[model samples]
Target: MPHGDPPVLGLVAGQGQFPALVAAGAKAQGWGVAAVGFAENTTSGLAAETDWFQWLKLGQLGKLVAFFRTHGVRQVVFAGAINKPRALDIRPDFRAARLLWNLRSKSDNTLLTAVAGELRREGMEVVSALRFVPELQTPAGQLTKRGLSRREQQDLEYGWPIAKAIGRMDIGQCVVVREQMVVAVEGLEGTNAMLKRAGDLGGRGGMAIKIFKPGQEEAIDQPSVGLSTVETMLEAGLTSLVVEAHTSLFFDRDASVALANRHGLCLYGRSDGQDGGD
Candidate 1:
């Protein structure tokens, strides 16, 4: 570390506001943020927020690495979500192909751990963005003005373990439950689609439970909820949300809470061994 030379961070940007928020947090801490953004999947506004920016296709692992190294980034954070279906269209280069080949399973955890390992081998450490933006981590307790009703609490209690089990299997982060019956489990279609499907199948008053996958590398790919999530839940007639406390990101927390409060939706962050409610 030298005077006037801040720590440089490489951001692997994906969709939504998460990457931008990370960039802001890094800058606020006097760090230089260089980003490699995915084409089409990443937010366009992120380019202006970073010290350096490069756009690349999903499978351009070599390019992503070179870009960060060239910009003097020794640490990186993977932020935001990549639409999994679109990822199938990626044309992996030699590096990515070899990495993929070495994997025993292509589940999210295995793949990301491999990528992180690759980055580590390249002298770049993969760190959690929460290190720079601790505020984004969801705190334990009710997040909205209104508390969960008895039925909503029941639904959360019923769905929590199921969601964790699905996460442990690397299946998904969310499950929609109503009246203690599973309405939908989030798959490659993502949380929003799962909520929509739940609305169609079970109608209103369903609870969506999202949790960090067991044994996941927490530095990347943590479950996240944002304003868009609240909007989607409202549209899908969902009445409550349960996210794993401290292991999930809650972007735009105030705005999300306001919107959920307005819509009379309950948002709770529950940790292991704790009951969810007001």
Candidate 2:
């Protein structure tokens, strides 16, 4: 490697625009991004944003590591998320399969930690994606013109800790509640599906709360919300949304708040300190 060349930052990219955002942010910080995108999940535009890029299938762990090492990447960040279905259907190589076989639980925290451990064993540092894109961290307080109404506030209070409980169990991060009763808790079907299902069971109005898991590995994963979340809420007829602030990655705040305002929905960023309800 040339002595004057920029440091290489490897990216393990998944679905959505997050990989691109991380790449742009890393470049802005003078790091050269060598990103690998999962063909099963990442957006097509990601390749153009990277210094070196490869489209690889999910669970090709050895190939993933070899690609980064070959390109001289010493640090890596896992950005975005795999589609739940695609991730569940992964066909791991012998190396990856061994890593999985050693895990006692298939829970997210355990699995991602093992993956990061494998990278570390190969001399690559696994750093948080937030290190490059700190501005994407969701801010605390109400983000929309409409604040949570009395009923909706009660619902959030009712559901926030419950969401964390599910997350702790690696069951899910998001929960839907109405009138202090649990309407739905997200499973492998994911948030959007859970939102729609909540509407089916609870009718027009409920509060949705998504929290960071108690033991989640911040370096590799975090809850992501965006304009699409607001759109899904509008479609599902959920009236209020709250996410653990400073822990989740939020995107398109302006558009999300505008849409939420138009639909008389509430978007609030919360932390345990806000109400001691994590």
Per-candidate TM-scores read 0.95, 0.95
Residues 1-278 of candidate 1: C-alpha lDDT, one tens digit per residue: 35568889999999988899899999999899999888779988899999999999988999988988887888999998888998878899999999998888887788888889999998999999899889999999988888889888888888889988999999999999999999999999988888899999999889999999999998989999888889999998999988889989998899999999888989999996688765
lDDT of 2 by residue, 50-102 (tens): 99999888778999999999889999999988787778888899899999999
Worst 10 residues of 1 by lDDT: 269-278
Top candidate on lDDT is: 1
In order, the Cα lDDT scores of the candidates are 0.90, 0.88
Residue runs of model 1 more than 4 Å from their true location after superposition = 1-4
